[model samples]
Every structure is written in structure tokens, then in C-alpha cells.
Target: FDEDYLDPDSDINKMGRALALGGELDDFTASLKDTFTTPGSQWQYVSIDTHVIGMVVRGATGRSVTDLLSEKIITPMGLEHAPYYVTDGAGVAFVLGGLNLTTRDYARMGQMFLQNGRYNGQQIVPADWIAASTAPSAPTAEGQIGYGYQWWIPQGATEGEFMARGVYGQYIYINRADGVVIATNAADRKFREAGVSDQNIAIFRQISAALGGT
Candidate 1:
């Protein structure tokens, strides 16, 4: 975690080259760890932290995140297909943006959250965990957008409005007050181009409003 050696561009190249060279999976994982260790005490949003979180969960449960999620959520939710995680050379799951699920499957997760972690008459995730994770718990400025345990809350949104988001424009927006769940997946690399995210949030809000959000 050399602060001066934090070259994300070069890291991308290294990952690609390692894959091309058929390096062992452990090699990639080691490189990933080397490249993505925490930078500072600041609250920067690092995607690698997701992997670390998964490691923590695995350490606690002695099971992979994929296995836990599959047994606890995916199978019980009756998903049509099992979600997958992109893995390192050693087959360790990338717990952040590596998950791949169909739109309907994603919606099921959102609906579960909208129901306070209930799905098909059972609690998939703990209701208290849902409540805690969807609240504003980060160090963001007052009145600015807030971050919870892996969840994102738009600026000025009500307590019942929060979302799970990923790179690109993928989102599962929930408006609990209105009983609305919106799931979207996008391939827009330029999703950050001016007004895009705001527009997307506006659209979600509009949809929630149309559904009678409080």
C-alpha cells in the first residue's frame, strides 16, 4: 500500500497482463491486495473494500459470501438462476461489483429490502440489518448524499428512500413509503457525464411519486 505507488491505471494494466500471462489466481489476488490496501483514515469509497468486507464475513462464518448468499437468499427467493461472482485467479470472490444477476433477480432483492428483509414468508436478511444498513451512517457533509453499510442514499431523500448501487448505472432503488422497488442495469460507461446520475435519481423519484411515495 505504498501511497506513491497507487497507480490505478498501471494496476489495471498489471491485472490484464497477469491474466494474459496465465498467472496463478493467487497471483492476481495478491496483486489485488497489494494494489488496494486502505489509503488513509478518510472515508474514500474504495471498491476493494467490498472484497475486504467479504473476507471479514468469510472469516466470521467460515463460508464464502457466495455460498452464504446462495443458501440464505438466492435459493429461498426462488431465483431463476444463481448469481455469480467474478473471482481472482485463486477463485476468491470479488464481493463488490462482481455480482451478476438478472434484472428480475435484482428486483427480487429490492423487493426483499422493501419488505424489511422478508421474502416468500421468510426473513432473508435480518430486518435490523436492513434498517441499519439503509440509514445514513457515513461521514458525508450534512444534507449531502449519505452512505450506509454498502447502501447509498441520495441527498435530501427521506428515511424510506435509499438504494443499492454499483459501477455504471446499476441500481436497486427502494421507496418503502410507497411500496415501490425499482431495479435497473446499465452498460453506460459515461454514466457520470453531466446530469446523468441526477437524471437517473430524478426518474426514480418520479416513479416513486407516481406510486404515491410519502
Candidate 2:
């Protein structure tokens, strides 16, 4: 996220409706050229960065995203149900926001993070990565919900408080200090409404506080 793409008439926005319907990703990426010749010059929430990284992994590993996720995580987590990813019209996995999982399965992921990436007596993800990624290191606005590697650290986050927030209303909030994991799901398109995210964070903090008897 190092470019400015806020223009309503931006190339990506021109066919955004079609893209939402099922346009090819090539068309989408081509529409939006890389604006940041040098990254770290700025910080913007450009969603395509993740899809590009997913493609890189696919290219480097000669493996599908599903295969890698299943082998390295999903199967090991012993989820109650199999998960599926939503693909684009070209059949490429939509790496950004296409991962679909059951609420319990997501809670398992949250629990893994809560335990510093350990789950089911095994280290699923490196504890160091879990700590570093969830840290509020991003250059997000001060006093707002902060962005970590891909997690959300609410303002005034307490010891081990963070969340994974889906573009849709899916949220997995974990408070390690309280040993609480709250996974919620919704399709409210109005989730972007003002104060919605802050309100949700406050609610999660309240829940955690009550559970911790603090």
C-alpha cells in the first residue's frame, strides 16, 4: 500500500462494477498501474498488494494456495469442516478477501494466534511472526484503529489485543490476557459507517474485561 488510488475515475474504478461481477484479474491489474516505483514512500490500503503476493507464492512454490494452506495449516488445525476459497472469473484464487471459513474454524485460527501461533500441541505459525505481525507497526493515522501486518490493533489495545477484520463484517478479536476469542460474521454493507469499527472494538474490549473480571 504505497500509492494513491482514491480517484473515483481511476482506471480500476472505471470497470469496478465489472470486476465485482467477474472480470479477469489481468484486466484489473492492468487498469491500475503500479504507482509507487519505490515503496515505503507512502502508506495506503491498496488491496491488490496481497493478491500480488499470493501470486508470487504460487509462482515460487509451484503450488496452489489451497494446497499450501491445507498442508501447512488447515488440515493440521483439524477444523470441523473443509474450507473453500472464492476464485475469480479466470479461476485464480482471490487471495485478498476470498477466503471462506466456518465461524468455528476462524475461531481456531484466532485461538492459534492467541497461543502465539501454537495449536493442538503443535506450533502452527512461528510465535515470532505472530508477535511481530500483530504489532502496531504500520503508519496508520494516530489515535485510530491501527494496522499491523494484516491484523487490526484497536486504539488502546491492551496486552495481546488484536483482530483480523474481513472486508465484509467478519471479525476475529482475541485478547490473550483474558483468554478470550470472539469471532463474528455479518454481511452488512454499511460496515464502513462512521464509528462502526471503533464501536465494535469497544464492545470486544468490554466483553474481554467482563470475562477477565477486570
Best by lDDT: 2
In order, what lDDT does every prediction score? 0.78, 0.81
lDDT of 1 by residue, 146-189 (tens): 89999999988876899987767899999998889999998887
Error of 2 at 196 (Å): 0.9
Error of 2 at 119 (Å): 0.9
Give the per-residue lDDT of model 2 (tens digit) for 1-214: 2222345665545545556788876557655655654677656666677777787888899998889999999988999998878776777777767788889989999999999999999999999999999999888877777888888888888879999987646799999999999999888666777888888888988998899776
Q: Which 10-residue window in model 2 sums to the lowest lDDT? A: 1-10
Model 1, which residues run further than 4 Å from truth? 1-41
Q: Estimate each model's TM-score.
A: 0.84, 0.87
Superposition TM-score, candidate 1 onto the true structure: 0.84
Report RMSD (Å) for each prediction in the order shown.
Answer: 3.8, 3.1
What TM-score does structure 2 among the candidates reach? 0.87
